[model samples]
Target chain A: MKCARCLEDTAAKVADAPDGSGAWEIYLCSRCNYSWRTTEEEEVINPEKRDPYFTLDGVDMDDLMVLVPVPPLKK
Target chain B: MGCMPACKFKPLNNKRKNQGVNNLYRDLREFLAKLEEEGQLVRYTDEILPEPDVRHICRASGDMPNGPAVLMNNIKGYKGKRLVVNVHGSWANHALSFGMDKDTSPKEQFHELCNRWDNYPGEVKFVDNAPCQEVVIKDDINLFDLLPLYRINPYDGGYYFGKGNVISQDPDEPDNLDKENVGIYRMQVQGKDIIGMQALAFHDISIQLAKVEAENKPLPVAIALGVDPVLSFIASTPIYYDQSEYKFAAALNGIPQELTKAVTSNINVPAGAEFVLEGEIIPRQRFPEGPFGEFPGSYSGIRKQVRIKVKAITHRKDPIFENLYIGRPWTEADFLLGLNTCVPLYRQLKETMPEVEAVNALYQHGLTAIIATGNRFGGYAKSVAMRVASTPHGISYCKNIILVDDDVDPFDLMQVMWALSTRVRADKDVIVIPHTPGMPLDPASEPPGMGNKLIIDATSPAPPDSVMREVRMVDRMPQALEVEKIIAELQKSAGK
Candidate 1:
């Protein structure tokens, strides 16, 4: 696997996906210590356990804040 | 059990067949043998210094899934003096060391432990002879030359006798074994027959010493090293002041604890211990000790601590020196101290709020706690947080208390963090106490032993606002076992 930031062949392990699936994996470039995640979808995402990020809306400040790095604008 | 029963608890999974009864480890050697049999012990033949090198390996090795316990056979300077580190390193190994079923869930283990704090006086058998007293050296005592004492951190003051239990009886009740207190305190080797022991002011030993010093008398003590592995856990735990650890240990193992009277003092030492240092803490003798790395993951500055004049040294033939690294996370201290704090706190919290699902003392550091409860009333989490922070056993050294909803698993750091990030608000959810009792070693605290405490109410909102969460669940929530199975299958296929 190639790291997105370093563009070098890297080692990787399956990481918890944003949607909680085994499909996604995180790769790390050993030389530069850069990492990125990729997904290999094998099954449909269950609505009850779908990607929390997918359901996020600007008005849903709490969930949106959780998915993003920064807090949402005041209501 | 003198204390009121907090909650009705029965051991979980009783319907599951009981594994055949196995003998509990009698001493350090037997515990090592058990670990070896289970393929959980690794020995290093290469000579390593008793200082940073051994601790470094222990710190690194503890991160493995079921990390093997380390036994260093050769020391850099000391000859024929073997050193054992990290017998309590791994979670699996730690559970096994205490004769607990490793397959059971952490919640089940907590339930099983809830009733262990009762005041039942179990058998403490005293034999006429003991292995610890096989070779008694009353004169010409040189601690450095005889034992391979460890200097764990680079900035430590001097060589320390780590992982030893100091046994002392209340001076006022000289003849009563029930009033005896055994605690794990670090001893810095000062000279041929003297060592500085750090028994902090909060400890029961300090209280007993204060009373003795007021009476103008020295407190008799026997420091036992390399004892039965279970006793180490018992000593590290916060058994009430009135309860003796010997009895608690005896009750926990369903076996009698064997003790031997020290030659130089009336105090009793574990009969199966590898070594015993008989000594007395003089009425007013004080010496500078520490600036050493403590369990809080920081250095505690130098302070005046009581010094012990070693009157006699007793040990078995070929004694193994057991040690532990105090600083940083993911060490044995985390597991021991975490359970010690969590079990009692869970019981006490349950007495008030039975909805408390679980509690976790994050590291051996014991500064932070993660609690899971079902309470959803407005300001309920605040009350839960306050109760946990003020409980005598819980608040002693802890600074951060996080309360999560019942759906969150407190033991899993990821789940707890997820709750904190998704459910909590800095303005509304965070409650801060301006000043409270704090651990002396925490560098952030302004004064040595006093600081602020933070309560993070990470629980999901109650009533009308609770529905806003969208009843979310991670798809991978139930895939833990599947993930483990797949990983094992892949490793087997890859011939790893």
Candidate 2:
């Protein structure tokens, strides 16, 4: 399955419903790390139905900036 | 207008039981019971989706001025789990968190909090056993199976623990109890046992993490979920680095805070928390984190943040997962961070300038602050505004400062507008300093953490300034107070 946000095929099943009723399954995209459940609404699970502002299509993974730069290891 | 005889009315404290200071709650369950008793909590038992339904209801609650805290009992996918949001959304609920009367005004609550600020560094009691440890999961722990996680905003990248209080001690001074920090930072669920935390550069956790990273070692952290109401408030407060939040929580509630040690680490956590995730922040490790809806009513761009590897998860049976909904203005984030932001700034300002009356830093966690102070000299108000920009929390968060007269209550926007409209001469009253350190979550920051600071001096000019000539002010008639008393009595009788 392709991720709804990044449109990558890195989506893989993370967990299923704890009740063992086959109710829902959670999927996480390894590329962009967007996680969603199958039972969620179309806007959150389906790529076509997601908001355009949040979609990461055609975005470069290396372009994201680091919020806090990692400091050097002490000698 | 004719003068009326002076009515002998006592002060606010002399009238009631000091606004119910003895009603200290120990846990979220106790606080929820009190909220339900006060008609400030609402329960929805219908089965609902975790995504849009819960977020939509919480956003709608933010639209209401006096919305009740919502408790959803029956979620479709999760069978026995429960979720509560907006517990600190409205002024009424915010007042109830302090054990104050539900009808207490925000200004009165602000003053009460300020009055309690004098009693700093209260005691914390360590207990042997806690309910949070009733059920422990150390092997093969999965967050999705435990927490009823859901996206708060439609554009959020993933589910977030928006209200968790992260407790950590300084790596350099691990034995110093006063240096222990309990703060609220946004953590997103990346995998079953992995969490991505946004420890901003200015936050206390970042300072501790930096020290640990210098030695290339993991920083121990304990994430406390569904803490007591007062603990949530104190966690979000930006107090001095050396001050302990547990002690502040005790002082604010006029009682001692209860704490317990985590299973894997010596870090003390609130014993009343519903769940505790004992983890270690892997030093020098960064991963993609955000696009979460921030307090500034904007979506933070995706950035590489630190990752936490959970070692264990402990919780009380049938735990209620608490989350905060933050989007546009006036959401639960505003109320949660409102007066806690004000009291520290007010206390710091009073230390140097005793003439400062009150501070209203309710907007966006004090990116903008409204201060009321007395004019000691020609440009005293400007000096007060500059001092506000230099305080510990003010350095990064306070970008806009509005100074008004002591007579004008900073909590009332109408009075502030009147002062701004009548007293401010734009050329002389408005001052702007360029390239100041600012909060990165603020969208207006050019380089994400650097921006300009603005000060609007709305106080009346004293001697030698002479911006205005022969200013005449109108005073309220003595009969007005008598009329107010009469109208209050009439409204009470009519049940208005």
Candidate 3:
């Protein structure tokens, strides 16, 4: 990773830490000792690889035609 | 309105000897005191009994913020021995510790973390050796001889190494030594001679570690028992793959992180570390471990995991063992993994799904994560949801992904659930996808190493879906200024 400061090539890695009781992962580089998370190699998946037909609610994708805003309660 | 100064870094030199090293806190009292002074920590000096520490604290403390990082230095049983427990186990403390804004939403915090990553410059101030080297157990060491490693929650198979940074430098990537190849993975203790490495293959660190194994070389490893709050934070988050974790920490600390090389391995460690254990990962080492409390809120019994051979144990002269609990609700499980990794990760995902509004990692500890976004018609939420679940980090453990409207706070389980209840028809809005890489710690692992994941499209559907005409009402928390007025009046009346 290029050092954000000197732009010199350096060894770095993120440190494991707790951001309170919430969740967080810290990034750190060993060479220049810099820390931060970058969007460079991040992968975000809605459903993991080899997803099945049903979701957490047991709903299928092909046949479902759901409504938006969801009608309010009858009561 | 904006983030603090961006993270910065500087090059290290072998020319410097005995320069400045972080003041390593060997004593539990000193560690707490330092944290308090820096405002990165608080202490409860409250007296609490042992037998029920896990049940009493983790069960009741899940939702409270600003909880003293929890150091029960004085315990009734197990001969006192000064057991250091409860450090960084609250949501507010998480923010305060990192100098983040408490008023900022979790989703916003995640965004700032991502922004911080963009300008972060990893830094390391090298010193010959510091406190972690103050007391070294080079030859052979007994596990039980040191601090009390608690069996948190009843079903725990045994006392685990719940506290410690299991670090490994990529042996195959000597050329990639710009701090980009270092990794601090968490390992669970299985025996005096074994600990579990629950790394998923998708983790770049794990993938690199595998490369070392394939090359048949012992993977050099070190575990720092205690470190300054920010340094510890660096090890846990998914900031950047090529960037150094410590530099990210420096960015957070707004200062250079001091480092000293490990006596055994070539890996550099935080100089302020209370204790550092140096070792190596042997290839194909198997052990029967677990039955420990997982984030799923269950005792996942005996699973196959890698067994680590204890090498040398090194620490300050009188090191106090830090015991962090797991299982049930509000444990460090969510603190370090769920809450911490989620924020920065939410930002990284936005790089792909730019319109995504916010994200939250549920209490299920990586197994369940939620994301909220503004719908742009034509499967926008679904596509973004897919990317979120597919993120290298998310693929490993996140299942049960929920996408909600921007009006909903992904971090707020209530709002997410509300979207699921009102906008979702169970059979319609809910979109299911499965069979992805999962947490090795997850009990649902299929035979021959296979697992499944599902995403529930809980977002409000595209416009003109016939349901857009539906009316909905949502409640908001009281404003901060109003609450402040009441508190100020109460304080003044009491004073007068």
- DockQ leader: 2
Per-residue CA lDDT of model 1 for B222-329, tens digit only, reads 999998877898888765688788987776665788998899878988999998999998666565565467776766665656789899999999888888766766
lDDT of 2 by residue, B90-197 (tens): 999999988888888888788777767766778899887798888889999999889888889877889999899999999888868789999999999999999999
Q: What's the C-alpha lDDT at position B229 in model 2?
A: 96
Q: Please report, in order, the local distance difference test score of every candidate based on alpha carbons.
A: 0.69, 0.88, 0.56
The number of residue pairs in model 1 that clash at the backbone is 1
Q: After superposition, how far is residue B214 of candidate 2 from its true place, in Å?
A: 0.9
lDDT of 3 by residue, B340-392 (tens): 56666566666766566666774455567777777778467877777876776
The positional error of residue B333 in candidate 3, measured at the CA in angstroms, is 1.8
Instruction: Give the clashing residue pairs of candidate 2, or none.
Output: none
- At residue B467, what lDDT does model 1 achieve? 38
Model 3 alpha-carbon drift over 4 Å, by segment: A1-75, B1-31, B34-66, B73-80, B100-115, B175-196, B425-427, B443-453, B463-467, B470-496
In model 1, the clashing pairs are B334-B364
- What DockQ does candidate 2 score? 0.80
Q: For candidate 1, what is the TM-score?
A: 0.78
- Interface Cα root-mean-square deviation for all models: 26.0, 1.1, 22.9
